[model samples]
Target: MDTTILIVDDSQFIVDGLAAILSRKGYSPIMAHGGDECLRILKSAIPDLILLDIMMEPMDGWETLEKIKGDPDTREIPVLMFSAKKITPAEAKEHSLSIDDFVSKPVNPAQLIESIQRIFSRRNDIKEELLLAEGKGVDPSLIKEYGALRKSIEVDRNLLVVLRSAVGRDQAGRTPSPDEMAAVRALEEKVASSERRIRELQELLARTAPPAGQQE
Candidate 1:
């Protein structure tokens, strides 16, 4: 449920700065110094979104993105091309299916965050569309409730990510501050509750719908 973002850049400064910014905003940010490292990380873990730097040594962002899209395991992860270089509309159209969005270099902090949110929103909409397409005669309101609960879980998970950052739990993974401990406990509970509701909604939808050939 945690929204983990992979910040792929050749420059250590950029990756670190972006990671700091994202962590402060309650999103888990993982750093990959170049295309190779990014591919390596993908083999083990798939982040929710990838902020890919276009210019790099040895393998550029476009090549890296091609490899990413070529692999079935990693193909579906959304990518936002980050670079200082200007891309033409023709180029954008050429790779439209490969990447979700693009951001020029020296991104505005507020606008960057907004862009990331928009990407996630689009992902949610796509998921809802797919689910709805598969579900005939399922209550539209019920699907909406499922989506809302899923978003609630994501929020709680982000809060947990924030608390982890606050206490440096990722490194030592030991005792946390009392306040953080309490907050983490509450978030865990909230996430669990939302997950349970999602399951219930799933079951309800499954039961209320007619078989594939039969119309409601």
Candidate 2:
């Protein structure tokens, strides 16, 4: 399963630009034109993440976010809010809502991608730490496991390169074939599963490790 992302905004340009960027990066991007459209799409399928724009005609991003957070089914999907309006930390805190990150308008592609990557990377780290905390002891075999995990990450990075290439080709006015899309999707799933496995191994290692105050 590719990491599916939903993009919500009234601007066709933004939706197309983001879709192109994510598609090239091996993520499957779905678009919704407005708050109503977004909600409607959510009724059918849930995305792994959402990129929401704050300004729009009729219902705005803030209102859409509230609705999403209010609904149990959609609430868990991480949202990265984007806006031309300046956002303050206090405003974000006052919302009492789930916002994984915030991005500014006239979106910087590099910054946007970096932010998303950071969010997922941190999530993987936290998951690994939690797994370790729950373990009885660190596994001596974990060193080997770690090596294998690193190899998997390397493979994923290679796949990302392929995705980037495909995106570059598409940007030159060439459309990607179904086979290319399938390949990208497979790579995305592989990366996600590898990360999960790595976290589990990390937990096992943590559980088996000797306490700091204990002798070897």
Candidate 3:
């Protein structure tokens, strides 16, 4: 594979061992002695994955991970941390840190490979979701551009129903003023606008789709 992995650890022996194993597995391994160097290297290159050791001094793996996720540029890169301290995914989630995987220190090669495969597998699942969405007669662009449009339409339609009920009478059973009727009309227009946009997007997707029998 053309995957590049970055190994960050204060221990030279650990870094070297992980690097050798990754290289033998057909991955390009980049080494950084500590969190500082890791950030410096990231300024120039973003690796496909990061294997971080949690026992570094001053700026430990958790700190490094926080910095990486805080920055929009590197937040999406998957991070896997290993240490003898036994960090679990549930524990990581409690701290609001997004760790892709965790492995125990004195790492077993088989387990390490399994963790990496799991991370890649999750990514593949996301791609499959997007493909399925596109297959359901929706434009990929509309999926992003109008991402919350459907939910928003649902909410507005519900409001329209409530407003219509209020138009004929109030909570005390009195006739609604002209302003209440105007409010109902406004909500009706909003619902129509969303429905019109959805039709336009569906039409656009149909036009852009390849003709029948054409190979992608």
Candidate 4:
């Protein structure tokens, strides 16, 4: 894969291990041993994704994250918090808007991979119909609706991830309790609604597209 991931950590051991896993999974990894190095690397080369450790000396992950997000040049890169630190619900909620995702240390390789894949799917894979409709002369309102639906889908997906992580059951091959199941189901329903609206938008795009030789 051409996708490059920058892995920033204070520990060489963690960096090396993560690099190995990412390499075997077909990702090219750029390594940085500290927050300063990570920022310096960002100056010259921006990777497709970043795995940032949260507990560094001098500059912790939050500081680094704020700097990264504050910079217009590097703000758009998806960041995943790779740390052993327990993220309390409040911290997670506060940072949810800033982070693409997080993978707690004692890293479950499967969970890490899944989170990366989901982020890529969400951020990188723009809907073909959306692109085509934008290129055509679709009504601005229609395009706005499509954007809203896609955003709704993204919100629901994020909620699903947070809920599953909080319950600590989805990935363990164990059944979820009734409460967890109910929450998951509600999110799933919202996702389904958004998806259905997206399909309708696609069909409307097809119908409303300008005729051949007249598209502008």
Candidate 5:
């Protein structure tokens, strides 16, 4: 299947040009006029990658990037910033934004293709590395620590969803039943305890796990 790409730009010209280039390269490009539209599109389905313009009105590229990266659901989607602004290596280093690559505006088709290919290549490399590590039998302490942390994160995410749903129900004059409220409270306590356990497991792993180059 062709990889889906979401293109966010204020300029129709740039959007059209990018869509044409991506289509020619065998990618499926979906266009959004601005950051709000981009987010609305994401509500239905996330694209494989995002090509974000940095100079849109109302919500510029940087702000949009921040919003995307801040949300856990969207943070993993690779973002390539398409910008006319010259970004110094030092400036890019200082920025906390998780931009995968930057493509200069008046986009060069060759460079864009190369950048996208590199991103996918790097992703494959990481996947291979993870598989290799798993196959080698990761340290038991490390596994325990990671498993605990993952569980805690899942619990926290669930808590957020429940809280949001409860608020929505309340606003709709259909507040949660007493049993549901009690269940939510119990879940909150469980999440807190799980978080504490995860922290302890992390500390134990730090103390017991072998340092680099050490054997079991």
Candidate 6:
């Protein structure tokens, strides 16, 4: 079955353009002009994925994403945010938004398609893990731990982005300011801590996991 993708953007041009791209890639696109409309559509039918724009009337993508993630019914659906405004990893970290991915505009067709495919592939892997655990009579809490680890990894990766941006030289090739350097150091420590936690989680899951072809 062709995947259904929900696109929420205030601009008709962007909505139409993204819809065209996804259609050619063999996906059905559902369009919403604003966050309210997107939430309304979601009440009746949840799409396989959502391509959301950060800027919109009455409700921005941040608020909309919060609502989606907060809801029990729609929280699992992956959302990819696209925007003309540069949303730095620092901002995303501060907001604590559970975004699957971010694509900056104007959108690159190949990158957009690749990101979408990657997300679907990851979700499929998680679903398979869930099925395996169920068959083996493993504790369901393990699956929840896996999901939490994934989110932590994503957050840390974004922090790395912020660190990179902070350390980058200015347009004139001048060195980063002292404040920027300090920020980079702080971010580095956070990323290191997160990486260590991620490793611990992976090892725990592996040790506790059922052996191949074995069922409890």
**Whose TM-score is greatest here?**
6
Identify the leading candidate in terms of lDDT.
4
lDDT of 5 by residue, 11-108 (tens): 99999999999999999999999999998888887999999998899998888888888888898898887777654323343432366666677799
- The C-alpha lDDT values of all candidates are 0.76, 0.73, 0.73, 0.80, 0.71, 0.77
Clashes of 3: 0
TM per candidate:
0.63, 0.61, 0.61, 0.68, 0.63, 0.81
Tens-digit per-residue lDDT, 137-182, candidate 2? 4443665466546544643554355354644533677776766556
**Candidate 3 Cα deviation (angstroms), residue 4:** 0.3
> Which 10 successive residues of model 3 have the least lDDT summed?
88-97
- Candidate 4 C-alpha lDDT tens digits along 1-216: 399999999999999999999999999999999899999999999999999999998888988999999999999898888778765444554565578777778788898999899888866455555666777878878987886576456655665676667756556767767876676676677678889889998788778856479866
Instruction: Name the 10 consecutive residues with the lowest summed lDDT in model 4.
Output: 87-96
Instruction: Flag clash pairs in model 4.
Output: none
The residue-by-residue lDDT of candidate 6 on 50-109, one tens digit each, is 999988889999889989988999998998888877665355555533777777789999
Give one digit per residue, the lDDT tens place, for model 3 in 26-112.
Answer: 889999999999999999999999998888987998889889888998988988878886433233324323666667778999889
Error of 1 at 22 (Å): 0.5
